[model samples]
Target: MTALSNRALNRALLGRQFLLARTDHTPLEAIGRLVALQAQEPNWPYVGLWSRIHGFTHSQLTTLLQDRKVVRSGLLRSTQHLAAADDFRRLRPLLQPVLDRTARSAYFARNSAGLDTASLVATGLELLAGAMTPRKELARRLAERHPGRDGRILAGEVELRAPLVHSPATGTWGSWGTRSAVSVTPAETWLGRPMAPVTAKDLIRRYLAAFGPAGTMDVQAWSGLTRPGSHR
Candidate 1:
């Protein structure tokens, strides 16, 4: 086996990620090829695209979001990410175990003690159905249902447990400092599609195509997903 030096590996990643040089790919094309963009900061996706796509503009991404061609949701590493609608449908289900595990964090466990989580998620979903509700408002409504519990914590749990996506306005350019007012909706409702069934092997291959020649641990680190030994 030929050994690849650190520089060689770095360049390989850059080439795969389009960091070596910007490309003329459309925003949707770039986003799809990358699989997902780290977007917890709200503005990072725009920035990420700006660095990789030639002539990329904030409106380009905003339009894609408004058109439901792309979606901003909690994905890889259980953090916010911007994924093309098609990719999101496939990726979310494959990465659901990670999201489920995140919902079991200490904060949710302690805050929701003795509460029926299934019922809670159902109520939250019901409240958000057919409408994009701001996080604070969602929290308030959930709090009203379970008075005395932390509304913020309850809302956070709903997001972690449900396949929800943040409204486009929240991720649009110039919306960074106003994330608190962002709205959440069910991913399926927003995208008008069902979550696609995908295997760990499929995810692994996709991840490598975008950020690959990587080891199993690298994939796990990037995706917050565990792989069977055979997949590795």
Candidate 2:
């Protein structure tokens, strides 16, 4: 079969990732094309956009979040990320199990010993309903629900179970360091729409569009998703 050599494949990857050359795509359009951006802290995603867009500005992303067009949330690999608001509705549901797995791991499991799963999630949802809440405050409230438990750990677990987004204030272009007062809201309520059904095929198509001619392992690795009938 005819095939792209390694060099061609590398070029394709770079071009798809918007690294080969800067495009005039707006940050919003660029974000949709790229699917998601790493936002471990408040500022890294701005750097990602700055490198890829011509005349990229910090205000562009901040406006997007302020307008509810983009959101910062726990995404792939159970880590914080920035995704377009429309895309986040789908992406979070698709990766919900990944977040769940992280909570089920030994670290979280041990930290949350004796915490009843249903009560914990229900209480969190109830508390987060109808209002945006500071992360620390959410933890404090969850701690109140289960007096002996560490509020921070319980809040973290609630995050894994519920789709939450940090407020635009926290996501704004500020210091290069992590923002200290992050606030969160339920994704559905904040976006005013429920999550889209998980369609691994469509998500994979997005993956292949950005990084294609890739092997199953490549898709699995990049997305933190695995499928049956694949090589181990």
Strongest candidate by lDDT = 1
Query: Which residue pairs does candidate 2 place in steric collision?
Result: none
TM-score, predicted candidate 2 vs. hidden true structure: 0.93
lDDT (10s digit) by residue, model 1, range 88-109: 8888887877888988989788
Give the poorly placed runs of model 1, Cα more than 4 Å off.
228-232
Please report, in order, the local distance difference test score of every candidate based on alpha carbons. Answer: 0.87, 0.84
Candidate with maximal TM-score: 1
lDDT for model 2, please.
0.84
* TM-score of each prediction: 0.94, 0.93
Clash count list over all predictions: 0, 0
Per-residue accuracy of model 2 over 1-232 as CA lDDT, tens digit each: 8778999999999999899999999999999888888887778899899999999988889899999999998887787889999999987888887788888988678767887887888898899875889878889998887787788888888888889998887776774443556788898899999888548877888888878768888877776766712312
